[model samples]
Target: MRATIALALAAALAAATSASGQDLLLRGGPIHTGEAQVEALAVKDGKVAFAGRLDAARRAAPGAREIDLKGAAAYPGFVDAHAHLSGIGFREMTLNLEGATSIEDLVARLKAWDEAHPGREALSGRGWIETHWPERRFPTRADLDRAVANRPVVLTRADGHALVANSAMLALAGVTAATAAPEGGQILKDAAGQPTGMLIDNAMALVRAKVPPPDGAARAEAVRRGAGVYAARGWTGLHNMAASREEVATEEALARQGLLPVRVENYMSLAEGGEVLASGPSRDGAGMVGVRGVKLFMDGALGSRGAALLAPYADAEGTGLIVTPPQVIAQALARARTSGAQVAIHAIGDRGNRLVLDAYQQAFAGDPAALKAARWRVEHAQILSPEDLPRFAELGVIASMQPSHAIGDLYFAPARLGPERLKGAYAWESLLHTGAALAGGSDAPVEKGDPLVEFYAAAYRHDLAGRSGPDWRPQEAVSRAQALAMLTSGPAFAAGREAELGALTVGRTADISVFSVDLLSAPFDQIAKAHAVMTIVGGKVVYEAAR
Candidate 1:
């Protein structure tokens, strides 16, 4: 049967190659059209031209470059609904301590980096989490002081919601035990009333502002490098959360120069997006770059105990901090309604989610028409009150989530929220059942930013090693089909490009991701092992794995 199908596909491609005008043709393996499976697909002028039987596609587009799948499967291109592109690039260029096993290991890595770059005045890095550390606690200033006491050293937690600074950095920032933390932030102190050199949420600005900003050239390079990395990893596009005005300008410049490898939908940070919000959303002519909305934070991340919770943390003292006030969220939503721009707010805890939901409801109530037009998103939506789950659908809010977060956070989430709150933690399927839209993402630099890993995390609901604790709530795992949509159509809908992107239909853009394994039929374990064979964006092949 396989041989027979191959012969037929070859004949169809031969017929297709005879005519002119079509851009490309793909055949030999399954092609998921979002509606049904097809044998072949053809592209023309960057849009899908035909999707059906190989012979039919060939007749429809008789002169296109043929790409044989070679047993691989093709689906609508995957889009990371939430990510930080520049951070991904910076991660590549800077010191990364993502897998440090202990505080000593992290300190040693920092020491090595400091010695290697002795010419630099200050040191900065990110991607360190202490959840699995043997010490079972957050790193302190004394730990980093051992590495580089002379220069300022600031290392951010993996969640980006907090940072631990060396004594030098704390001194440079003028942060001391008497220094009051800004609203919606925390300056962790020792029992003796001394600064611990840990700053959470808004408090991080003190040290961060002291670090010199990167030049325009470096900023542009970061955008270019990040886009290339994502394309090679099978992501056709990304919704860049917390994008700065400078980064948006950098992306546009790269797109204009034809240097960008993948599509980028930018949601600028509230602090830097005043102009974009005033001007409203804008897209490039080629559909490769877009300034879509504003990204706001409702609270910090759960890992750092900064996420605003309704109740005190199970193992800690107080409820997480509210990073943004309800009045501020409401004001942003109102502005977004008038500007015709989407709003994507980061909310990780039950209280944070509730605040955002309430603001969205009030904003919608005032402008029913705007509400219908606005496909506003709640990024992370990691932990939600059971009652607030249904409100997402009621308000037509998009739950922009990262699956890898669930898998990684599960290791420590049980302790952070205890068993009862775990019920609402990472409740993906439950949200889906409530008719809420869930757009999947990787949140790279924080996570690995690999589409395959995200898919595996969502479908299996297990750690990389396939472990799942009893309280991990394996029942929330989504079906493979649902997972696929989350990365494709779901993101497209979230970005308001459902009519143009996402599906492998005749009218949609020719963005397709061909993978080594058939995701729909492969064993759950094999999904993560699968690699991208070919990535097609806007009818152009961006990345192809070496044969």
Candidate 2:
């Protein structure tokens, strides 16, 4: 592995040296440099030499490595601002229920999985959501124990925010009737007040321990495969949201070994133990697996009604739990500020959003210098009050959102939020109008980690499946150009990598994706069909679909 990375680095340097004097240029195609001329690009030393007239590129970067755009709309390499890579990587390894709509269907899939893997003692799988199904109600422990009797079974909810364990699994975790819910989490109980194996928020850890820990090699392999999966779909770089210290180490090793296909913006959290900054900042990470941010969950998700809301969910009388409380926020912020790390907080509900914004505002208001360099992030930003919309730009925080989520969650959001409060939901364009640079993402496993789906949702403001006629907020929809910037320069800025990656201009990394169809001209639905024909990272072809 060391030899391989050395060889690749040597080749990259050789290419940079060879193209030092004479420039490398690509002409004819229209380029979107995010803020500059929409023309050709001249590259030298793997950086953009010049990006202006076609004639200028030819004159400057002569004899340099060149790629033909072939009339395709060229923009900066895409950056998925938020995603669950470990979840995406391991999705195939588990019982995936991304689209299961019925309890019967979910049970059948799990039964089939258990039947196939005979005598596998403990069984695990994911993908069960009562909200999207015809019969919308949370599944109980009996539901799972019935399928796999005595085996310790623990299946994660579609969103990594929660999980459902069987009787045996609960026993293994020592979760009984007397178990008390942890701060920022609740243990769902049966009618008899017994633990039902339905764990939310911090309660998931109780059951998670019973599951075998994935080895470093296995996780590394999973992450590498996950990167390849995204590259094949036109993703040049990605934000690995809420990763453990060990996962970051694995990705770092993979990148150092030249096995990483995608540029990862690693956001760390001290999940079970170890300090994120100490364990990570120890390694500067160069540009491979950069750990400059920390992830904090302010509240739970909207699907499970665990998302903290000012008012109770219209569907459920209970209000959502506030996952990360004030004290926790202050404590984490202290660590982050001291460690010189930016923070990314997950705030989905109104109260959650308000609280996170308030905490950040207080942190900044306390010492303006603290935020100048950190560039904190708020993941999801799913639902927000109009009053709190501009808090992002005001505090210089980035609203790292997943466009696919707006449309995907719309089916049930309105039902829970009611018509009165619906105005504040999925307000992407409003955030932009409020002067916030939106960073686009897929949120992966939670929602399919497809860049195109994100683009469709952002630009068109509609679902690929076409749930609503036009879009939820058609007037608020962002133009393709604006959406492109969110996925590119916006995230680039978020990661503090604007100068190096994102854009395809001179003095920047040569990370590019060539799509089969022109992104600008492709019809709405055709986008989902469009695939990345060629993916180049650091002037090397990482993925190219076979003709």
Candidate 3:
């Protein structure tokens, strides 16, 4: 049957090529290949067989599938370099606190949720951006206690860096005033130094023990939903930032069932599971899924003052937290290096970024050959001390960043860093100028998981609140072309899959995203509404929204 189908496809391709000189000639569309000059593109078997004028493209593959683009635009299928896939799909099922600006709003939302759910065990949710409120601070434990009273409730900040829980939650987790602070974490306390519901960095582990883990079934469904959402947005693939072995297995199962709408590059939490460390990145020899690297969280996020910074936060007056101890990071890097698996270390703060870079530098012996082509990534790379920016390029580390973060976080970053420290935040243009490769991501549930939003932020550097007046040091903003590249070829290069994906070159994989609007010339605000008309992967139409 497979051979018959192939023969039929070949015949169709031959006929199409003979008649029109191409299998699928996308005539006259502005095809941005993440390269210079947005040109026209041609495709065959899901790969760009040729690109340019219609006549030339048709001549290259005569009598092929002819797609009349009618001046519509096309770009590469967005490559989200970092995102917690399962985490996003389940965000709706959890305690969401993304945009509750004030304490009253947060309490109201939780109370409503609690009332609706009735007999639910506890209140677990996310998406509370109280930093922008008139109070401009995190909610205290005393505040949370009033909302839930008895039920153990734990809510995550919008940035996914901090947690706010109630007294019941603290009691349930046995976190008390006597619970001493961990090495790199802090327990929010009252004036008398008693435990509060808020926890930062390593201190989150205190209440984390009480939150029940998602079961196998829930994980499977989350992965399924995540894949659907990705494909719906014209994403042919994703690099699952930090997932466990079970998540990998779930993705593998979905891939086997041919249910996974997008191809996933699964990185592991462990260096080795079985004898597989020596063999290489696959559990059961599935081609769609790959486990090539391990993810390590070096520090927490900046919004929560958990990112390890060189100096203390401009406002908070305290150094950011280092979630993972230096020794642990060092050991992990060494293990990952020897095991021949790539490592993606999450480092958002200056201190965290420097520490991870130092670990990589130390483990790899500063020798290119010793690292074995392992594309070590400093995920987030949000805030870098000026001195450490060059190390990303110098050490051949990939700076995997989420552009949406810049725009979203800009509302409060100025206050966090005052003015002097603002230079180090979301320095994409600086990173690129320094000859470093940038991998763009959404960070999923942390952001909206929208490629257009990321592109706009990368290109414009302005948050929704309109951080106008140069948009937070506009010099550090990347051009639209560069932004597209970061989401496309940059990540492809980081994953070592540039040869197969990323560009509209022949013999490469056929994964494409056809947009309804010209991404290069599209108005900034309208970008969010830009539609993906067609999403083809491996020469098959996975998603096609009719005109």
The candidate that achieves the highest lDDT relative to the unseen native structure = 1
Superposition TM-score, candidate 3 onto the true structure: 0.89
Task: Name the lDDT value of residue 268 in candidate 1.
Answer: 92
Query: Which portions of model 2 miss their true places by more than 4 Å?
Result: 1-30, 36-40, 52-59, 64-66, 69-71, 272-286, 369-373, 469-471
List the RMSD of every prediction in angstroms: 6.0, 4.9, 6.3
The reply for model 1, stretches above 4 Å from the true place, is 1-22, 366-369
Estimated TM-score per prediction?
0.94, 0.89, 0.89
Q: Give the Cα lDDT of each candidate.
A: 0.87, 0.75, 0.75
Per-prediction count of colliding residue pairs? 1, 6, 29
Put down candidate 3 lDDT per residue, 182-297, tens digits, no spaces.
87788888889888688887788888888887888988777766776666666777888777777788888766665666678877664333322344455345346777777778
Better of 2 and 3 by lDDT: 3
Tell me, by TM-score, which candidate is best: 1
- Model 1, TM vs. native: 0.94
Error in Å for residue 191 of model 1:
2.4
Clashes of 3: 29
